[model samples]
Target chain A: MDNIVTHAPDFFSNSQAEATKAIARSLWNRVLTSVCVALSLLTLVPLVSIIYLVLKNGLPLLSWSVFTQLPPAAGMVGGGFGNAVIGTIVMVGIGLLMSGPLGILSAIYINEYAPASRLAQAVRIVAKLLTGIPSIICGVFAFAIVVSTTGRFSAFAGGVALAVLMLPTILLTSEQALMGVQSAFREASYGLGATKFQTIVRIVLPDALPAIMTGIMLAVARAAGETAPLIFTALFSQFWAKSLSEPTASLSVLIYNFSTVPFPHQIQMAWTASLVLVAFVTLANITAQLVFSKKH
Target chain B: MTEDAARSSATQTPGRPDFLTVRNFDFFYGKKQALFDINMDIPEKRVTAFIGPSGCGKSTLLRNFNRMNELIEGVHYSGDIKLLGQSIYNKEVEVIALRRSIGMVFQKSNPFPKSIYENIVYGLRISGEKKKSVLDEAVERSLRGAALWDEVKDRLHESALGLSGGQMQRLCIARAIANRPKVLLMDEPCSALDPIATVKVEELIHELKQEFTIVIVTHNMQQATRCSDKTAFFYLGKLIEYAETQKIFSNPGQKQTEDYITGRFG
Candidate 1:
């Protein structure tokens, strides 16, 4: 087959003009490739610098006391953000619990049950709009809802704000995940005598589980690091929370309040809390990857 | 059944029962017509294959049997289809129940991204069968029915997606039969398989007809001739010819059917 093959005279042997043009084109391609590679690396600079700065300032304050002791008052030097860490965990946990089911169910309704209707379209638009809404506005909205009702800044209020912030991310990611599932799986389920709901719950959900989980983990991580919402709802507490109605000391809020203070010790503790927040978010992401990779 | 004998016999004799009857059935995808004025009776406990060129609506007609076409948006149909002398399109008929009695396997093998055991027992589990022993037995029975028991017996707990293409298709067959459907519709089930897997699935279909009324749509003429008890030749949304498989292959009554069988035109 190779022996019988023929080539155009100009294909194997180019004229001087064509050869010069090809060389110029190849040089242009090399320049373009290098530019693209440089631009991609340039985008990572901000994130790498942020991590570096946080680790540089925060690692010095990482002692056992940070986990065991409470935030000290003005002029104190050696205290930890124990209450803030616990508070961040509780509020984010509450937010996840609230958003997970609602987001997943809405995604199912949009992707499986009512995909063609105007209502689903409207819902999808609203979800996209919600994701674009600033986190501070979510705080204000939660502040209006919870503070007007209960007359206090509380961990529950913080949770409500975070849940609001998390819902759209969860909904959008989960919807995309559910959409990623192959139609064949749903068809197979329906072919086997399963109802629409049965097909969704049994086959579609399981198939999209990895992606859905990644979405939920992303939402949790986003919720954990959010400071603006906590400022309005959780406020700041120097002590551990005694009840859901009391002001909570989440890590993000603690960092926000302490970083602004004149005390050097409080600023040092704020950097430490920032590092812990990054570590917490990183852990959630890693867990999501692990769950996503596990075979069903 | 010899071609001469089956052709001489024809179809729908005075005494023989028709398990499924389609009368002047027409189907549409939005404004476009897919199946036009189809009329036939499918016998019970036999393999009926629909052969046609691509997009000739053989698969559409098969999907109409269990209302699977309704899953697609903008699809509508007219005329009545009956199962066991009762209208299937009646308002009183629940589609879920209808599908339970009529399983389907697609051209592509689709197994749940789950364990082999879970894939087989999915139908039973959805129907509220919670007994461990019963589920375990069903897994074995269904896998055996699809002729995949020996290959996957040791690794029943393994992921169905991990199986080879042929094994995955067989697992889908096993999943379908686990529901013990009265009718099984296969839409070009072997189109993606290699010749060896195709032969295996063809043999499985032959054995499956003993327990289920099997309807298949295929592009492969040899496959239609090899396994089908009845063959319906479709052309451009019309049923050109339908008769015993032997007659359709050897002595097609219609000129078009003969032309198609002889590779004159699609």
Candidate 2:
């Protein structure tokens, strides 16, 4: 013990140098931390400012009449894009109906049935490429296919446009969700003598359902907010759509039309429509989060 | 009654009949060979244990019994594995039907995210048995067969995931046996369990051998001694020795088997 005490003084003498090194490291850590915090706050600026601006300008025009009444003539007052809101909902619903089952079933075939096949690999590459295509091209494609054949713009054409855009999102996300299901579950099912179809339907799909729902909800939000595709397909209708085959008004198209017109009341209505669209997207996102959290 | 009499009289010992016979079996995963030429006759109504180090091909052989390895992209085998007198790899043999008659339990406990009752009756449901009374009876019987009915009876309607790890493993056993398969393949069933749970599973294995032909792959040498009637020791994808469990542990024929059991080296 006495021999150890003689060496302890040397250990204490180097403590000052160790303290200096620690201070230098901590200063660098603090500087990096501040820079990250500053950058992250900067990213939030656009989102927060948009929300603040929309609420400030849009709140005064938001009323029951805005939801109930139809759009008035140019330079007139006291009207709402009620038909446009309904048209958006109907068109997105139609797109979901068209694409939801197709995407999910194809994903199941790709992930569970033919995961390693060359054809499945090719399909996956094409689906990824489709996601990066410009939205306006989808509008043009639908115009060529649906509008030219039907002889007029219609909600059905708008739905086709939206479905094309939503397909890649749903397919890729569902594929990822299916892949994320642990292989242990499938192995256990197969061990118990389940057929491949039975194992996929009973064990794999139910396990991946929540994640698939989240993907669908995200696609729904994106489809609802799209503007360019609706313009070339659905076009704009001053009156409510009488049928799916007729021209339809949508909130995105209304905002596009009304925001640029030389009238004060129409401009205010556009801001109110923007707020409603944002709310719809927010609600869909919240639903997705809720569904995902319930699984845990 | 006459068939039963003839079958009983054919074998002098209770567990002497060859239930599963493997001859010159070689297994490969893609280009990599996982098991060398192997031969063994696993007896009916007896527990056979495979003991080896990691990557020694014990688990691979166990999976081949039910053809579970076919789930991989590129796995192939040579020679043949026969259940009863029929080759399981025959062209006409449906792989699904072959698997139905031979059940399996994995090393890690994996109960589906479902009610305990549904988990146990999963096999029956897939086989098209939907009568409520029959399903309820099977659930009770299988859980009792696994010695887990008493602890989980009241919670049969609850999610199987809520159970402890040991309970979940026992649940898996119940599910495997729900179809009343002729053979049960267990791959290191108690490796993830504690000592107490291991003892429970080992005891269950002892009781299970009276009805099902069991083939187990385990790294625990003591477990083989405790629960198995026959033991096969392997090293480097080759079967080093096969004998009665008593003889293998007390008087191993090969130097490698002795070195492995005595902790000289794996």
Candidate 3:
């Protein structure tokens, strides 16, 4: 009671009250700051350990042959995984070709053309649901559609599966990026006598390009590492991919398959393949930030 | 500019031919009506200011001239708004061509996040003006028209986002006038500007009136008096009184108009 009475007038002035408040704020800040820092450090542990293991196990196996030859037979160790690298690129390229335009256009329609309509709302909800569905389910879907019809596993089927997995991510992220564009810009464009199509094509899309590219890169990176979809759709091949109609090799599926084999050489190659997959994903993200951000 | 002289002059001015006319206009957003039974005539090559408190439908009436309010979904209107004696709402009149003749500036400074030069020529480019020399000349002319050329001429290619708030607003004005529209609608163009910037914009408005018909919506009573030739006071989405700028400020005929201008109540 005495302390409260002593500080009453100073409280109105806020000088005396502010000093105590500052001290308490500093204490709370220190505690919360340490807690957040500790949580961040904890989050880094899994990522650091994964990198350490990949580097430790895969560095000795790295060679020029890794990019130039086919994988060796079960117990032998002289060849490399040029086939898987090319197959991964081809599948991912096809996935991008199929999903990129479709996803971006759908996002544009949802955001710009019919944002508040029931159809757009339905598309948005389904896109969200698609993202949450398991990757294996996407593989099963592609298998049911393409593999069952063709009676064989092919890179085309794998690409379709991967594209299905990428579609929801690209759609969601592109919608968010396009929506981030200020309504003022749209109004300005409209005020200047530009048609809706002209405004979207010339102003809205260009402004959202950097963010849209980031979304595409992230989607592609996720598609590149997908293992379940490719296993069901592409199956596996030891030879270089000759056509989109044939079974194709991929880094993720190869790692999953070879890591389980009893042979020592195949297991070592699995680690190398995992390292390469990680490198590809990292390079994709880096290039996206570097290249697209420059335009902004 | 005296009170009695201004009243007679405004009363006689109503006989002049109107450039834009709104007749028994009613506007709605979905089921809720926002404007009710508004009728007014804006003269050519003159600054007609709409002064009212917030949500009084001043901006709504301005937007009708260019059909900008149609951009919002579920907004419908019942009225005939004629631009140069032709009904703008007619199905025969294309919205793009209508907008090309009537440019607008928003209350907020919304310069595109592009370069200064690109911002000015955006309208022209969309209309298929591709000659570099033509675009370059338009850039200088529009910037000069908006009184922004001197400050921005050195960095025409720099991002407009790098400009100051006042500069950005001026850039928007430059962009709007680049199309050389017959009528210009400014929705509180100086509301977001500082006093100095506000004065500069008012000066620009005075000069622009010689070339284009201007309808301004403003909350600032002094701005309406300073910049507008004819002043219309709106209250509760109704036009209470409109007269010469001098008469509206000095001696309003309606109690509501007098109360609003004197700050007794909004």
Candidate 4:
């Protein structure tokens, strides 16, 4: 007891020093937190500025004619990119039609049927590598396969390019979505005497449908904004495409073609076209988020 | 009832025939043996409970009855599991047909993310039953059999996920019996339920044995004694004891069985 009484003042003195250390530690914590907040806000600056600039420059020229009339010739005014909008939609639709089933089926095969096989592993690695390939290379590959064979730069060829680009995204996301379904669901279906195919189609596929739709929407958004592939394959027609075999005026190609011209009217149209493209992509992404959120 | 009368009642009848017979069963998962040479006879229309510690091959044996473990990669078993004297592993016996006649309920309640009506009819639907009247009748009968009809009868079209945990488990039980399989395999079906839900499921099990042979794998000793007619105690992937549930709980033949039941050690 006498020894403890003697050490009491020393313990109080040590605690005072420890309190100072704690204050320093808390000060460091607050500083680090502020730094993280500032860095995250900095990361958002480009996205915000891009939207702001597009709205500032494009909203003035945005009118009903933008979706109703064709684009004017260089140095001319009074027309809009109505054909380009349709072409974009048609080509993206074609891309989705080609990629959607193929991607989803392959994903199902990989995840549900042959998950541990060497072939599945190889396919997975190939899909991952495909995602990293430049979008321009996909354009070149499509040009070789479809453009050379068809002997023309056509909407079909552009669709082929976008399909190649969208395939990896759709495939990987669909696989992830299928994987997200609990194994318990499959076990229950199997336990109830459902065959492999029945279990997948009836139970697993239904559960994964929302996520697969989300992936498709995201792929659609990406395919819409892609400029390089459309440039090489579609090759920018001024008039509306007569058929899928003919060259088409997509929104991305129109913006690229018009932005380089010295004409002020076409430049303003480019800004408006940029706004339309941004809006389309944003709508697609928002729809994807909504679909995914609703599922959870 | 007195202990003697209860024991006599729980004991198998003299002429009762075996529904499932396991002969020299050995199981492996990628070079690691999960079960050694095992032998057992499960009688028809009786509830047999498999009690064991974790990883003691109780669940594995339960799953093998329906070939559920075959879904996993690198699982193989040597041993003839005979269902009514027909080898389940025979080349002529289709696994799908085998599974259809052997229904299983899992430890967790896994109701399909669908309507209660659809969930009960899933098995029949996959088997190509399309008549609406027949499906509706099956839904009612199975639900009543599982003791869930009164609670969910009015909301047959509602999603099964909206039900409480106990209700969902009963719904699963309802779903399992919808096919009217010869044998029902339960892998800790009541482990996820509360005390009230456990009692309800236990009572349901007692009622179900009148029509189906039930093989339940459980960790709870009291549940084994309360619900099962015959009990098989397992330890370290071996069958330590097999006898009437009353005899096993009251006077175990093996020290290991007594140790496990009395909570001395797993």
* Model 4 complex DockQ against the native: 0.62
lDDT of 3 by residue, A131-243 (tens): 99899998999999999999999999999999999999999999999999999999999999999999999889988988999999989999999999999999999998878
User: Which wins on TM-score, candidate 1 or candidate 4?
Assistant: 4
Off by over 4 Å in 4: A1-14, A288-296, B1-15
Residue-wise C-alpha lDDT for candidate 2, range B144-209, written one tens digit per residue: 999999999998999999998999999999999888888999999999999999999999998888
Q: Give the TM-score of each candidate.
A: 0.92, 0.94, 0.93, 0.93
Model 3, residue B74: C-alpha shift (Å): 1.5
The sequence of per-residue lDDT tens digits that candidate 2 reaches over residues A3-89 is: 564456443434676556667888999999999999999999999999998898888999988878899899999989899999999
State which candidate, 2 or 3, has the greater DockQ. 2
Show where candidate 2 strays beyond 4 Å.
A1-14, A291-296, B1-13
The residue-by-residue lDDT of candidate 3 on B1-266, one tens digit each, is 86447435644454345789989999998998888898888888789999988998899889888999999888998878998799999899999989988999999999887899999999999999999999999999999999999998999999998998888888998999999888899999998899999999999999888677889999998899899999999877788888888998898888898999999988
lDDT of 1 by residue, A102-136 (tens): 99999999888898789889989999999999999
DockQ for each of the predicted structures, in order? 0.71, 0.69, 0.65, 0.62
Q: TM-scores for chain B, in order?
A: 0.93, 0.95, 0.93, 0.94
**Cα shift from native, residue A195, model 2 (Å):** 1.1
